[model samples]
Target: MIEIAVSALLGAVLGTWPMYQHDPARTGRTSPSLVYTNQPNVVWKTYIPGSPSVPIAGADSSVYVVTQGGYLHKIHAQTGTLIWSFPIGGACWGIPALNPQEDTVYCTWAYDKKRWWQGHVYSVRSSSGSQNWEIILPGGGSWTGNHLAVDQTGVLYVVDCSNPDGMVNAINPDGTFKWSVPVPDVGGEEDLFALSVDEARAHLITGGWNSERRVICLSTSDGSHLWSVWTGSATGISACVDPSSGTVYHPGSDGILRAISSDGNPIWSANLSVVSTPALSRDGSMIYCPGSNAFYAVNSTDGSVAWSKPIGSSSSPAVDGNGNVIVPSSDGHLYLLSGSSGNTLWDVLVTANPLSHIACAGWEDRIWIFVTANDTVYGLSALPVEAKENLPEGFGVEFKSAGKSIYLFMPNDAQVSLAIYDAPGRLVQRLYDGVLSSGGHTFNPTLEAKGVYMAVLRYQGGMKSLKVIR
Candidate 1:
């Protein structure tokens, strides 16, 4: 049996980890593939001031979004109510990153004023719209493909392109500078895009947008230079790192994808010509690359084409619980495709204008997907909300998580007892034991072990159990 580790971190990060084995030689993709074949219905929708350039992040009871209007808005996940809005007084073209352990969200913004370029790295409290720490980044260049990344250690990394020559900044969770590395110039311009962190390997990998367009790696501990490999033409968007294998996958502007080891050794390079970042399967065996007008699934080990299909303009692809490939295209539509065969399962028009990348949240049979198009943000349900009606009558319990808290919802009040047990049926702790009222209940359990456990709830003479990861 595959022992899946549970965590308080919700959505993609929690679902993808150890469940998918990291085999550098594993050419096969997901087995017992989960695919969504029907068009998902939109559950909720909201409007923003400007277009969103980054993927939306959902945590706790809120969804965090950043708009080009220089506004960061936190909205209720179940409802489209606005929680709070924070202004950066500039353009935010990048996505916001969340560190569940730190309980903070990190984002970047840039604006021009007077004779200098102004840029900032904002670290804000995830629960509240309050600032934890903010630091001004150097340079004053346009924000194109710049990405902000945070590791499990709460160390934040960002590429500042405020000047013609870009630079990388490493900052602490408290918003202090750790180290800064100058991006080497190529030709007459130099910019960086697509940043990722391999926390276990203590390495930061990023790609360049100009000059020889190199893929560079730096030491995360001290920001020291490590190795730089020249990828032909431009390095596209960002790269994906497999911490288990110390492998890095980079997309190229010249329609090629390169795989390099942590030591800067070349593994293999394939023709992808993708401009955006590529998505890796949970097991790190398959790579999904999106080009100007097509999508390709390639073998992670040899870069051989698994399958290719015409998908039109789209951002990076996201895989759902059923192993279904979700792609949001520039044509104002979202398509669900078969993960193993690249066959279209469903197509739904999600927005009127183009779309930013997609973000998702999932728990068991339910999946929530969020996408931003033009000035509108739409939420879709892979398994419609009405499906909940199928639950048996009586007291019902559902599990949800974000950050470091696990939420439990009880439909009706009754005498209840809650406890957690390890995979071996060893009771870890008793969370609650008493009469409770109806509505949502939350438990902030201290689960430090990185493994699977069971949550057992007994109420109203009925018992339900859930498998939880910490």
Candidate 2:
């Protein structure tokens, strides 16, 4: 009877041990598949009227979008549902900027009143869609159709085209005027068009409107003049700041993208035809931008093209947390490219003109893409794949032999195992039996006879077999 009880206890322990060996909660997180170039799985698409500008200000799993028909919309980044919309009595040609901490959105609009284009700015609560404040520009002029930029401290900056000499204004969050600075008067023939802001250094950068195109940086704190540089003649310039390094990246009408230091010194620049504003990688090691007819990745430190692909004219590229780039193109398709190589990994076709700038947020272990067109928005889901061949997910691996030991290097973490089989098809040894992290792992093969061996790696819902000659 004592022996029977001991055997029963041993069986119970074995049954429960398997349960605890690989708890689904610990190792069964739904990781991305490892299939090469998996196609984009569109979650949902909602149609809207009129072409839409880029969606912006993603926070708490939602994206705020604006349309050309004076409509402001809040979309669920994961589900593509329209949570709310507010009409501002004009065309919203630019994207909305959100102050997530303050739960407020700042946007600009233009309406034709009495044959004149009237421009106005409005601040609305992000949660309730209530108008917090409104500021109308003085003496409505022809709207140049530019975007409003917000600084770190919640100040809004915009260009006032109504003045013969374009003016830049800084307003407090509550709609009170802080300061305004007049742009140097260009000949009446010149027109100013786009604006960007650097909040850390309190500088405002504006581009477009002259035979000699330029980017002027102005102080946001007091509207003081900082620095300005001429970027040969061009139009449709866009600029953005690297959130990690505070470096300013601006694409010029001249088809050149430049990186400027915080103090306004040129770090590096690249020539491209109609490039979009640079989208920074999460690690800040690379910048993704749209070329004239392709997407390109450039090294952030020196502005060198690391990779380029023919993906057609694109909206501003969005970099996901896993270092994948989601690019929307005029061809009516969203392409996912490998961030390191600009290789086409996947593509999903949508309605025509789905080229609005893409915005991404991490939700429920998936990266969500918000695409806008004709007043509609679509959400796309992307999950990371598993590591391949001992390499980390989304990376490569290599093996080298040194004397009696083998050194293996993987770019990412992976499940790996090794076994030795004799000519009689009998298992001789078991080398390893668990998952390995990214980087190098070393093992001694000296104990095995000088014969053929096998290494097996199971990952990404697949398996790979490698033959080793000992």
Pick the lDDT winner: 1
Q: Candidate 1: minimum summed lDDT over ten consecutive residues — where?
A: 15-24
Q: Which residue runs of candidate 2 sit more than 4 Å off their true CA positions?
A: 1-40, 138-145, 186-190, 202-212, 243-246, 267-269, 352-354, 383-470
Best by TM-score: 1
lDDT of 2 by residue, 232-310 (tens): 6555545666644667777776678888876778888788664566666656778777776877788889988888888
The TM-score values for the models, in the order shown, are: 0.74, 0.68
Computed on alpha carbons, the lDDT of every model, listed in order, comes to 0.62, 0.58
Candidate 1: stretches off by over 4 Å: 1-39, 138-145, 162-165, 186-190, 200-212, 363-366, 384-388, 392-470
Clashes of each: 13, 14
User: In model 1, what is the error at residue 327, expressed in angstroms?
Assistant: 1.3
